[model samples]
Target: MGRPKTSASGASKRTEKDAERALNADSKSPTSNSKKRHATKETRSSKTATSPSTTSAPVVKRKRAQSEVPTADDVTSNKRSKTGRPSKDQTKSRSAKSRESEAPALPAAINEVPQDILTVFVFGTGENGELGLGPKKNEALRPVLNPFLDPSSPDAFHIVDFACGGMHTVVLSAKNQIITWGVNDNKALGRQTDWDGGLRDVDAESDDEDDTTLNPLESTPTEIPAKQFPPGTRFTQVAAGDSCSFALTDTGLVYGWGSFRDAQGNNRFGYDTDGNIIATQETPIHIRGLPKITQIVCGDNHTLALDTKGDIWAWGYNEQNQFGRHLFGRQQDSFVPSQVRVCRGNAKYIASGPYHSFAIDRQDNVWAWGANSYGQAGDPKSAGGDSAVLRAPVKIQPLCQKKVTTLAGGAHHSAAVTAGGQCFVWGRIDAGQLGVVFTPEQIQDENSIRCDDRGKPRICLRPTTVPNVEQAVDVACGTDHTLFINKSGAAYSSGFGFQGQLGLGSSDDVEVAALIKAKTVRDRCLIRTGAGGNGSIVADIAKRN
Candidate 1:
């Protein structure tokens, strides 16, 4: 079924009025639901989050076969064999044999690691097994390797994109396939069944002392079938919400899975042809009725999609106007896509946080909306609001025409990159998410930057430049931390370090960006994830020496 129309004032009506009028005209025609278009948004909660770290700019990489391109039709057949992959016993036996044969322990660092050494390293709280490091090892206060993406191993696959939800992680491989692990609450990972007769558990509450064995969560990367996509279409991007997962196909079609619980307490799996909730598909289902989609991004509970026509549409949660719907007094959420009317100009980049959203227009202007409880919306004055919400998209004047290249958000912070690669961050600073320290004199300049009763900086309302990160190419955030990648492929991290999500090998929170000295072969430089996770995944490009 086609999606329902949103309120007329839903999106940025001022600039997108013409586009909305056109969409309105098309919505009246039956063909509107089937027409093709293109784009995507980028964020979420959880242990990690990632927006577009790589830009439209060219990156060195090998050519892939046309058939390998994932399509919306590739996953049409949902049928699968009862027995999936090798049994746990078989896997353990294989590992034991290999360990016994490959005896002598090598040096701590390998002198010659392959160029494609895609490593999945995680640190911090694995209490919920979000680290994917085996249940017994709940936390890695230090960066540890997953070994799943080790290029030196025969089973390794080159990971291209990664996203983290409140409790789960999803990785997209060069082969156009997806590998997901970690928390599976609400079937967010879209796994058909618990691997190995339920070694991974769903919706696990705590990392209790007695919880020692595997929790049915995939500790290792497991591929979800791509047969549901269009023929010859490969997945180009992936995203995660607090409890949902989304995939953007090369064909510009989006497929999403995971439950969307309603106020009535119904566990709705997916929308049917008519956009009504259906039983859990426990698998990826096509998100239809929108223009041809090019990009798909998610926040803690909401999603935003960008069309090639420069139009942005949002759905799901709107509790904090994260959908840019101006929803108030608990009229939150929209089951289907709705235009973000306030988003003016063709959005070249977009990002969402746990409770906020950001976009960079083709004109290099940056706009933000949703929750500003901690000045996360980039408005210093609103930091003291009774509701602390932006309600609609508003341009961050300080950054509007700075040639903003890209944007990112965390659980409670925002980031923007300029054409010159200068990175600016604002919002929650309690955890040092902004990657800056305020001297008493500087704090006095911005009234909203005063200290809390605990003497911690209340919030950074304006766009404060992150130091030592010039020429930053990409920006992403976790629940209370942020990451920046420079032109040289080096990464800098800051914020809550209790879980070591900062990649700094220590749990001490830093008031400034610090280089993550992760040991790797070549530069395992590309890092993504904009939510909370104790770990991260870095993909290696052999061609990008």
Candidate 2:
């Protein structure tokens, strides 16, 4: 919130006008992460057998601004979802209960994902920067302090993981590169910023500009330049949705880049330089046909990867069916990623919500698919009207009998965490986004929640329970809040906090789970947490001597 480089306003600073938010932003938690909430390990291509390839091709293709057509909801999802729908993939033995729940050798992601060295914390709205804090501070009701990602400064630099996008934020660098910031319009901050540039070229003192007006480079976080990739390109994971962005590569390729709107904003990315189809992807392309992926998730506009044989693929913006299949041309088949069988390949872990989708195969079964109106895709027989929407991927039956691990959601509600710590939650519940506390005879049951009309409750499809929140490990979702942490890092937050994003310093809303205590993240040893639509991001755990 500083500002005095000669009363600077380089890019004509705002006096108020900046409100227009919402383009669908953050249903992005590595599409389902905290490394799937812990226990599963094993991956580096299953201990170096190397074989699985298919890195697609593109990689850098820039040019954008095209559109080509395709939007009556993709010509009505290529005319009525191809055939009929409904299934949940049978049941009973359910593949021997998903092989008794793990250890066939495929769940490690370099030790469950978050590789430490981190150091970033933001809170509610930065106008469009979603609070990485800088463009002269747009907002932050609580957990502030992002001092250029501070690690004792001198331009320190560490990060390792981050996603939050519905406005922009993609980070992930312990040197592996890919740092983005807020709203590049639709480039989703994959790189490049300049609200106006050139105020005598202000360096003010340039440790990332603070002497004012170099215009906090879109709330500054910058990077994207390991010469743009191809030689030892590390990464590991990154996800964001609403306006697009993705990254995953410890070999299992996937690079993506902003632009997949819809619900009227109308968008698409990838395919320029005459390869046609373009509409936004300002940089970062490399999809090359898929397969060999491992895990990736982001549902605001769609994207789900998984691959390495366990298959899942899915492209973007498939109306409500969130791409469980069926499409005929309009989006040229949704931008070409394909293959979503959901079961046959036995996916091990995946999660997403903003539209819907989830996975957890290899015997621990727990699959779901796209927008089920308020059922939040947990599929209690597809909950509401028009069968709510599912179209394909089934098999959820209240998490078949638990053991879950990790799954999250928001903008309709969802949560799951099992393997001893439990957790469970379900859609909407009006607004407190289910941090638990029902019992007026459990909100009048009605086969597990649906109240409203004065009675309260309002939406939920099953999976209940959630109490005191034990060892959760991690869980996020912020179209209405959810946070949670546990296993000692302690953190909790419930729903719709006006924009304080439930960091618990106020801004209202909550129905149970509170605790975040503020003061710039209360002494921080905190493990991880992310959510973006309005704000919330916590990482901590960096200290060392």
TM-score of each: 0.71, 0.34
Candidate RMSDs in Å, in order, are 17.1, 23.9
| Alpha carbon RMSD to native, model 2 | 23.9
lDDT of each: 0.62, 0.65
lDDT of 2 by residue, 483-532 (tens): 88777777788876665777777666688887788766677767778887
Off by over 4 Å in 2: 1-119, 122-148, 157-162, 165-169, 172-222, 226-255, 258-320, 323-326, 329-332, 336-370, 377-433, 445-481, 484-511, 518-529, 532-545
**Which window of 10 residues has the lowest lDDT sum in candidate 2?**
1-10
